[model samples]
Target: MQPHNRRTFLALGLLTLTAACTGSHRHDPDGGDQRPDPDQPVRLRAVAATDTLLAAYDALLAAPGAQTALLQPLRAETARHRAALTAGTPSTPSTPPPTTTSPTTPPTPTTPAALAVLERQTAQSRLADLGAAGPPLARLLASVAAANALHAAALGAPAEPPAPAATPTPTGTTPGTSAPALQKALSAEHAAVYGYGVVGAHLPEDQQRTDARTAYAAHQSQRDAWQRLLTTLGATPTPAAGGYRLPFPVTDPAGAVKLAAHLETGLTTVYADLVADLPAPHRPAAATALRDCALRAHRWGAPDTPFPGIPDPTDPSPTPTTPTTPTT
Candidate 1:
């Protein structure tokens, strides 16, 4: 096994043991307790990690001039992640709560390249935690980790979860009448293709226009693949909608870029969920697809998160036959 794969395997084993040692309690419906829930210690740790990343973004915002100004969207995304982690902030009273020192120390990446490295590490760390998490949480973490790995690639740094070098292991599972994941991925791809058309129409610049065209083609190809997969599975795929609602109006080149980023970011979440729904041998491909969406989003200037697709204070799922993210 590759060194990276070996490390991930070890981490998964260790963390699964940790979760088994303390994951019996169910989430409390009441918000009355000042004490932290034992079952949610790791969830809390994930929250702390997000907080640290948000603090880093805040520091960047405090720095001087144009570079800092350019990072506003990225900062907003981090804030969003922090909010997502704890499922909205707890309404704490003024009294001092009992203390437990946090195990997670956020990455201190100062430069852009260093930041990319930090994100990659954060993603890998989450992948380790995935094994201990339940299906919902585990799938979400895997998706985020996959996104961060692609973030490293987008920034020209090494991928945190090493890219698979071996040929894919063929899936032996019998095709069923259901293929909800492929259908959903197909819908998302349809939206992506349509959205890119709008994006291309607005961008007059040669490079950006070319980028929009490329993205459009990619989405079309992906959509066709999903359709083919569904057809093979004896499932009838949903046809694309004639239109999609835009998150916001796109009036200019900058707006078009923002739209592109938003579409790709959303698609990453869709692909992540699809990863969980797939059979084991097919998961690596879905995981790869999830990362591909992240890479495309990064190109359009989406804020890089320590973990993508999850709500670390921002927002959201699963994958891979990596012998890690051992989803239940």
Candidate 2:
């Protein structure tokens, strides 16, 4: 295994051990006090990590020739992350506010590459914590980690090499359990495969067509995997609709690119839910899929969000409309 993969595996094992040790407890009878929440430390650590990254962005933006156009969107995304992490966890006697570093007077030598490294490290750290977190927080951490991974790539950094997927263990369980989430993901992949065909047709550029083909192939593969998993689980995978109604018209290349972004953004949300639903050992694949979709969405000009799969409560925009399924 690669050094990073080994490190991640060790970290996850450690976190799992920690969770098992501390996750379940009752009121302290000796002092008649409540036990501390086990997830708090993990949450606080994540908040601190995000704050540090946000400060780095501040320092870099303060420096000369910082490429505001490129960095600004990323920075904004970090702020959204901050908001999400800090929402219910307020500063108190026990939990202090996350410390933020003021930009230095001269500001340290900060570059996009350095920031990308930070993003990658932060992402790994969050991934490590996944095993220790509660279902909701674990889902959030996975989403943020995925976002940071994409952020690293957007900064021109080498992509984080893919981790090996865990071997599937089909229990022959029914749809009332985790199989439903997998089925949902399969449905999204189906729509994505269909949408990419439309996108490829409208994209005039060779590179765009190539990207479309790659995305199409990827979705098809994912769809097949979901089907296999469902079959093993004794659940029937839903058949793809004859056609999906597009949310908007796609008559030109610009429109095609928009559709592509839309496809990925929708998939990210589906996979994020899968992250929360799957068993700990299996969650990594769903998280990776979420990250992949988020990166594709970013490249296709989708607006960045701190939480890729989950909707940000801070945004007041109306709920996004999903593609309607028409009868065959």
lDDT of 1 by residue, 1-328 (tens): 0011111111111011111111122335574445544325556656555555556555556656525644555555544444444442244212223333455554455665766677677666665665455445555556656655654464458533323322223345634523766666676676677677778878986988887887777777777777776766667877765434566788899998998898887776666665556654455555666676777777799886644543332322222221212222
Best by TM-score: 2
Against the hidden true structure, what lDDT does model 1 obtain?
0.56
* Residue 139, model 2, lDDT: 78
Shift of residue 123 alpha carbon in model 2, Å: 1.5
Name the TM-score of candidate 2: 0.74
Q: In model 2, what lDDT does residue 36 have?
A: 62
TM-score of each: 0.53, 0.74
Q: What is the lDDT of residue 322 in candidate 1?
A: 18
Can you write out model 2's per-residue Cα lDDT over 1-328, one digit (the tens) per residue? 0011111100111001101011123345465656566677887888878777877888789888879999999988887776766554434223334444466322333889988988988888888887677767777888889889888988989855434333256543323488777877777776677777778878866887878887777777778888887787778998765545566787899998998888888777777777777766567678878788888788798887777877664465556543333323
